[model samples]
Target: MITAKTMATGLAFAVLTGGTYAGASTPKVKPNIVFILVDDLGHGDVGFNGSTYYETPHIDQLANDGLVIKNAYMYPTCSPSRTALATGKQSFRTGVYTVPVLEKGNDQVSIFSRWTVGEEHIMYSQPLADAGYKSIHLGKWHLVGPYPKKEMEASWPLKKKLGQPKPSDFSWVPYHKEHCKAYYPEGRGYLKNIGGTYRGDPALEVGGYKSKTGGYFAPFSNPFMDQKNPKDKWLTDHLTTEAINFMDEHKEGPFFINLHYYTVHRPVVARSEELTEKYMNKLGDPKTGQGMETGKKKLTTAQYATMIESLDDNVGRIAEFLDQKGLRENTLIIFTSDNGQNIGSNLQLRGKKGYIYEAGIRVPAFVNWPGKVDARRTETPVMVTDYFPTFMELAGIDYRGQLDGQSFAPLFKGEDKALQARPIFWHLASEYRNGTCSIIRKNDMKLIQFLATGELELYDLKKDPKEENNLALKNPETAQLLLKELTGWRKANNVPLPPNSSLPY
Candidate 1:
């Protein structure tokens, strides 16, 4: 295992060598990629990341047999993180700073800059499809703008018009199908799309977003997904079945499966009575809050655990199916979550889903390829934007695009110094559950600048992983350096600020 001291030395060497780590070349044969993105899963929610309450044997096995990325991060929320993953660009570049609408009212304080990522940006799937890969996108694809007119009008009605009072106004255009259809998974580049739509949650077709089950238990409301099969009870299981069937049909050669599961996100619906009962027995009682607390109203810890277990079970099913089809050897499976845990516990990490802290941005991540990626844990910080270039490198695609991330493909070949000298960034210009802020991390030191208040917070993550102590005042030079870099990055990327922000610095 590579220690921190060795990694620091590697960082020094990388800095001197112009940020390049010497490692083995890319694989000759393009491996089949199975990128599994879990919605709202926290860093410590999995067994591999030290979660004792949630049993994730399949996920744990993958981490044990593969490489676990200790410092992988995403955006504070789902939309921006998914945007970075899909487009290989920062939120500033894509103009998707937060969710579709500012959750916390869009007044003069906060403004929703862009409803959805523009269709002009090229999705990662396009390059993969061009490289002779049969790609299929299953489950949630929230990159598309807002829901259709009916759902938007009913659920999220625009009380006061901000722009012109016409139907063609830019502010009122996101609710239409014509605006969103071009950004769906199929239009972006995936050969097939199942259940990939604008809806962020699994709202049922009958009662809309407030449906009892949230469309988790059959009769899914997703118009993009085919619901002809009566045996499809759980949404997770249904998506997994579709993934397996797709792989089975295209088992001849290289294929890409973007299996983004909507499990453990919202509504907190249990997969089955048996699993719920099992968790209830283990968690004591939900009435008195005796077990794990989800921090969400009407969401019990047992129900949350059941959702996680269901996800793990389906992960195991996918692995088993791959093994059965003799595709496990050459298939590269990347498992990770979009953001932090919203309902369940994030272990000892600070903050929740919408905060710019460890719990909100840091997520559980791992890369498993039987004989390719060796089993090891590395503290090389990787962002969601890095996946696209990594996939391109692995597939030998010479992409010449404006990407805000560097490929960490060398790390898969046991190059621990691949990303030690790199600095990852996050820009949240809109306020939701947390304030608008921009964060930068270089090595073990991280600096967060609150845009609204211009509060500078610096923490040495190696010493204080939970960000309990602020080192900005103590380490003035380091804080200033990081702040300067952060400001330069924002200016270079043309990052917009909240209307109520006061950057005193």
Candidate 2:
């Protein structure tokens, strides 16, 4: 456990020589951490990850210059991923197995949804805050309870009037303002929060005609953000600006910023006319090319590509800021996504987001620490939960608590062979497609057990990355061993199962 005295000593050392007290012999400098989390970004979405459609030069260059984690895992959905990341525990502990509500169209809830992440949990930032790290949370902050209970109750009449209430209906008013103030990033641990709200994306419009809450371009309906875009800037650009400014303000020593960009998620909007036209002409069918990816067929391939490019461009902006400020060598940038790819992009992977398949859980993760981490690719299975311990170790703090993740800081230092072998577990107990399921991946073998139906699917991820062949029945021994381990872990964690009663659709 990192006592307050230890943290104070580390802070004193950092103040004097820009290094931390690793011990009497070994002293290490804590790097400024910039954690960039994208929403609903797919495994095959970035240029470094073999996305022929989208262009991500900055992200690709980061991967080329740093470490690319090929087998990094996250929860199948946003809330679960954020929950595990915040608490350093799996979904079983947080009860944030999936997005609170899984709605069909926009109004009808097909899945049994409940409030997931709450304020009482010990978020990673709380520890960092105690360690004297000035933290900022930019962009989406869905870890708060899905929404105020009052807002959910207010939507009933609108739901009855129109199959589903519009995005505008729930975005603002008296209640939402109160809710945002009560459960936003500042209420959590961030000293400053811009564009951080309860919902995934406030860009939702009410009409079934559009898929997003609101368009990606401002004027955004986000209550937490100011409508100060006179030039009608893109949301990603605005967020990048805020993050760069925050870094500049806190360029003294060690700091942590969670820049969760709300781009490339959904309600896929076109970028500037120039970039949109470039992608459209580059990838769109000449004769079949219509408008952006929102009409008739809603072929948003070109729009999605543009969104990625914009995200990459903003990343370049951050990189430039770090370099120009001479902070690149001391800043550690960790780039990843909340969940997996959205539909229409990840065809090669088994399933899209919101499933137990690799496509839904496997995400692109890259860590860059100049003068420390080297450029390489690792197939070691690392979960988002591991980031908590890894960052704590980097800050020269010993975090002792009930944590489900092990620090991969040793792997970052090129001691790749030193990492201890362990099984990474995932529990998605919500009313999605196949009901509730639990997964455990040990080494190259993975076993998935379905709750609704007593079924098991085993796959050798090394041999079949696509999970095409299930060797559960064929290799009973391997399957049984995996099941025993998974069940034992579940029993230990007290992971919840779906209720016996039929779910309300």
Candidate 3:
């Protein structure tokens, strides 16, 4: 059977020689791309997304200034979602079903030992490099798998089996010696990767160096970050400072900067005591809103609210910088989150970060390009994988590779009807709240199948956005049709089918 990667590659090649895929009117020059991927932000976290609690003035303004994709979706967790963004392929193609957590054995690892973006697969930066665009990565970089300790170098398969690519491959700079020679970002696709180490910060040990300090704060347990930062310095402010500095240096023409912030994830560190108190007063004593699966009324709401406000403040800072540099009109700003909210967020949407439900997969996304992308709300279903092709298309480069995602570049120019019926797929072999499951969404109808018990659920998202109704048994014909498509896609992608242990045949 032909793999999904091969099929996507063939399709990509077929469109390479084809005319401008962005439709009749393509921009004369490529716009600077600044992608801001927030960590663990939920669909209803921002003000524009109907969050009655958190304050996000800048994010709301950004939505007012550009186009908001109502049906944007990402992987339930971090690694696979980011991998999809980087490679434009699904987990089945890149072998990163989730964060690379291997259950080691004495002799052999699981047949599914494959993780991390495969060395051969084209990264998002690689295509942009040929287009004369300098790429920079800042903040969280969970794509490179777990950081290999110096002692584990000998056994690190990421170093031997799948070594890192060259610097020209993407310009990932700040490649250090402690980071296994082949595992550095400079050798990949980023030109400068400040604080862009494997996994999110506060991970205790980074690049073989252990940080004994607190996480997220100035005294962070991250080696990539400076220990000299003022004790009061916040990670969000520090990263925004680095971003502004980068923009100051590279605001001339075209550049791609991936500003992946590690805010609102864990530890829920607030930027300032004043802000925390401010939110506390505003939210009252109880600080009640929507909480995670752990239960409602999580006291962490004030801290989470303050954290989101800080993120918004930084967004304002960037927007102001662009205006000051006169680059606002020509720049393309894509903002969204990596996955769902943490264990204690997501208002109306069901489930939290670790499930394949609408709340887990659906995220808030917007694109701002001044005169290019008009300000409006579009219900077009966009996936994390679509950004790769969209960016390449914007750069006037034809991407002929295996991509599970297609370009929605036309949507930027107010083309709302494009990609109307595209099917977005998600698979998580790793365990989560809903257990091992796979999902496929075509139009408003969604089908989720559990791998452990072969249980299936069908929901018409249009009628029931909350996903309270399971139409599987009630609508047998529609369920079977979607089931057939889902199973066929699994087969085509060579996905492993779950065993029916309960069968009494």
Candidate 4:
């Protein structure tokens, strides 16, 4: 816990030194915060991060205008990542290691002791709301409730299935309505929630990911979103318009907009025919090989590209709205994603969404506050859990709670050695396309421990960005030291492990 006096001193220093950065000046008032969280965007998807396939001029401009973090990380899947962001705690504390029960397995093989985040945990929005900031949450809220109620469990979808039920085997919403209502964004301190709900993806509300429109287009089946205008054809555009309206209504003072967009996720559909044709042409060019060579089919890749473009367009709209309202100088914007790419390529990354590898955990991130944050690229490592403490520090709130993340607030003020060298961890006890595992990354060294087989894979991330070589056998000392630390962490946190699994440490 950071003492109030220490926090005050740090904030005062930041305020006084705002003029140190080029083209930056101190602001007289509190800065409004707009956190834009995109779904399933990879580390190499944005133009600023070297993606020639998908165009993202607006996102690139935002990164150029702010601090781009080179080594940012998140959980392998959405639920754990969002849970970590909301509570600033690891999944072991919240019991949301992966997607709900389907990926969690039945009682015979289940690893998770709990399925949803408890109502007792303090969310990042609570402190902001207490400070008189009107906050709104838009799009996917998968943190609420993912497990079925006790009564509903009598008709458990996989009560008598074979060995273990796959995630695709279950299709119905498993949560009780009233039980989950208390965990919604509104109950958790947001003043308003536009499209947030227990549903993980847009397609879940209409039908399983195969629905024609998959709720990406207008006439969405999302019960939380109230559509009034007939011109609101695309879901991304509609969410952005709502966000602009909220900003317009609250233009007088400080506000917090948690704009979590459910774009480029599963059920990939093009926002418009024009955008689809544009990507098709771009991919068909000889300069960039056709989509078929990229693992995903050409049409699917084209549709996914359109989704990415639509997200970028909405980001531009928000940026333009801020500038038009004269709120650019006083507003803080953060652009990031939940996890790695789901449908499209993850560039040279080792694995995609559900694997506990570089591609699945690492993500692209940038922070823009005009004068407060320096416009420079940094190699400092950051995590999704760090956002809560960072936001609390920026908001000038003295938060005295148990958090597993360190605040990277000093990095914004051009402090290169702000965060200390410490071991960061990820524990995914449940299975999600990969086996149960725990990971530890300290400095440039990373170790992945497979629970079932007790196999260890070590990599020096500085040399092996793609994680092609496993150095566990070659460099036994470093791997053993990391494993010792990881085991100590799990034991201290009382992290749940799979049944009948053993750890060498």
Best by lDDT: 1
TM-score of each: 0.86, 0.84, 0.83, 0.87
| Candidates in descending lDDT order | 1, 4, 2, 3
Model 1 segments beyond 4 Å from truth? 1-27, 105-107, 147-180, 206-210, 283-290, 293-299, 416-418
Residue 314's lDDT within candidate 2 is: 95
Residue-wise C-alpha lDDT for candidate 2, range 16-115, written one tens digit per residue:
4332223112126667999999998988888788775678899999988998998888988887898899777777666666675552222232223444
Candidate 3 local lDDT, 206-256, one digit each (tens)? 322122222566655455666455444778888888888888898886888
- Residues 1-505, candidate 4: write the lDDT tens digits: 1235533543454344331111122234667999999999988888888778888999999999899998899998898999999988888767677876437455445454344466556688876787667889999887754443542343422332222222233333334345555577877788888878666787643355777788787677776777734367888998898899999999986899999999978889888899877877774423323253443487788888888888999999999999999999889999999988777675467888988898898888999888878889987789888898887776776665656787787798775554637778998877777788889998899999988778999999999988999999999999999999999888766677777467643
- Candidate 2: lDDT over CA atoms? 0.72
Each candidate structure's count of clashing pairs = 0, 8, 10, 0
**Using TM-score as the measure, what is the rank order of every candidate, best first?**
4, 1, 2, 3
Flag the better candidate by TM-score, 3 or 4. 4
Task: Give the best candidate by TM-score.
Answer: 4
Models, CA RMSD each: 8.1, 7.2, 6.6, 6.8
| Candidate 1 lDDT over residue span 1-505, tens digit each | 1234433553464454343322234457778999999999989888888877779999999998999999999998998999999878788766677775545655445655454566556677876777788889998887755433333333222332212122112343334435555667777668788887666777644454356777787766565666755477889999999999999999986999999998888878877778877877674333223255534432477778889998999999999999999999989999999998887665478887888889889999999999889899988999999998888887877665556788887788676564788788998766788778889999999999989888999999999988999999999999999999999878765577766888733
Per-residue lDDT of 421 in model 2: 68
Regarding TM-score, does 1 or 4 come out ahead?
4
Query: Candidate 3 — which pairs collide?
Result: 9-402, 170-189, 170-190, 171-189, 171-190, 171-191, 172-186, 172-190, 172-191, 173-191
The segments of candidate 2 whose C-alpha lies over 4 angstroms from its true place after superposition are: 1-28, 103-113, 149-165, 170-182, 204-213, 230-232, 283-298, 415-420, 501-505
> How many angstroms is residue 436 displaced in model 4 relative to the true structure, after the best TM-score fit?
1.2
